[model samples]
Target: MSIDDTIGVLLVDDHPVVREGLSSILESADGITVVGQAGSGEEAIVLAGALTPDIVLLDLRMGGMDGAEATGHIMRQSPGTKVVIVTTYDSDTDILRAVEAGAAGYLLKGSSRAELIAAVHAAARGETVLTPSLAPKLFQARAKEPPPLTEREREVLQLVSRGLTNADIGRRLFISEATVKTYLMRTFKKLSVSDRTAAVITALEQGLLP
Candidate 1:
């Protein structure tokens, strides 16, 4: 059921200018297509149901439904669709929330058009991409309370840093994929991060990850 040609993108933002600008940027790029657009989370849910775009460019601070809630709904409805969050907020909480919500891409508004295109393609490919750099400053921003990831959590995290999927991790460690997910869930709770990318980013920032 998966096609490998152009990556279909949906723009979700409350601002008219932002949505149009992003569509223009994606359309100008080769191997990418703008399939749909929405100004609110409700509209996005509707369009996503109809269009089922490969990747969604979501703004975090929207009015209703919000980007995080919309992301949850979209993924639940269309398991194959990838949501890429584009916003001005890079706070750890926001980043983690988006990741937990199942967003595969995160980029600030300051990113260049080329970066946006790259992120969209990456998301379409089921890869997570974080713009600019993963630095200490980011860790400082995202880390609160900062109890740190547990020992087992850190071990599983190290494997995650090695770019292994849950199935791969299970096979490598003689554990079930369900067990790997359990570890990941615990790690998610402890680190206060939502998804794997945020976990990796936080680990990298803390020098716990290579």
Candidate 2:
């Protein structure tokens, strides 16, 4: 295809190898050009504005300004650009955040080169792309009510909100540190968050915490 007929893609990932691998795969495909590669979300935002690529393959987790946040910014800066999240995480929270942030597609890193190329092309066409297996999970997560936290889980998160360390919370509650960690893990799962701060923020937003 001609240069103008090709789909321009901007790749965003914290790891150089990941970006390089993705670029190789994408550039090898017909009608898809790897226009730029960003090693951070901040860089992705700048490139998205400057390059105005047709598609952005963004990593979900990064050191600063995660994929979801970057997707939001890219969409606002270049409304015509379609962002497709390319990450290893298939967690419901991760998927929800990306989609809610205006991502046109959610694709796992394990996807085959064909799948990745197809997703880029599809996204460039303004279609929403999602791995078939994850589509149901996304729908279910959207439809289902937020899982309620157990009383002990709530207590753990409440203590976490107070900026207490796990050991400190365990000591205050007269529980073993391992047990405190277990509660935190359960709370994180139920909250669909990977970190304590997010768990607390999600809980507060959902009125699950005071």
Candidate 3:
């Protein structure tokens, strides 16, 4: 198909069900086609560079290489390809990091079919989409009291917002799970919040690490 006439999309997610489901959704729409699908971030980078799809629908939480890393690599390799983070996470840092990673839009997994379709269309049109619930936090990101995290604390917090479990964070950061918990506990106290969700919110507000 001609570039001007068709929107080529690549789906990057670990789950086969999600890949097929999104493929079905996009394929049924006129003027769009599922050019390829990737089950992990490494595959996504390769396919995105090779296929040069117009847009990529990426899941944030694959086991090894996550969406943010893939998005960054795609931006570097295929500058024209737009990415939309299709994630279960709505945490402020996750949304912001995807944005910083050069995603064109962020769509929660809870988004309706129409919402997903609209997001893809908008993304193809070079528009950004942040869900309504998240738009408030995104828009007011500069307005919150910043969390006072140490350098290590900040690093852990960023990964935490990406939906990484403490174990995952420990693996990524090369810290013990116990150490991860300790850092997170200190981060929570510093942020003046008591949990993972609130700490992420506080980080976004305070400009601690976006």
Candidate that would win on lDDT: 2
In model 1, which range of ten residues has the least summed lDDT?
133-142
Residues 1-210 of candidate 3 have per-residue lDDT tens digits of 355678899999999999999999889988889999999988999999899999999999897767876787799789899999998898777776678678999999899988988898899888988888999777665465445568999999999889999999999989899999999999866654456886786578667777
Off by over 4 Å in 1: 1-4, 134-210
Q: Arrange candidates by TM-score, highest first: which order? A: 2, 3, 1
**What's the TM-score of each model vs. the native?**
0.64, 0.69, 0.68
The better candidate by TM-score, 2 or 3, is 2
lDDT of 2 at 81: 93
What lDDT tens digits, residue by residue, belong to model 2 across residues 1-210? 236789999999999999999999988998999989999888999999999999999999999678987887788789999999999999887898789778999999999999999998888888999999899879876886666788898998999999999999999999999999999999877755567776787688778888
Each prediction's RMSD to truth: 11.3, 6.0, 8.4
Which residue pairs does candidate 2 place in steric collision? none
lDDT of 1 by residue, 1-210 (tens): 136588888899999999999989999998898888899988999999999888889998887567876787798789989998999887777777677678887799999998998888788778887776633434554565656667777878889988999999999889899999999998866655567876776567558766
What C-alpha lDDT, on a 0 to 100 scale, does residue 116 get in candidate 2? 96
Evaluated at residue 84, the lDDT of candidate 3 is: 96
Best by TM-score: 2
TM-score of 1: 0.64
Candidate 3 weakest lDDT stretch, 10 residues: 139-148
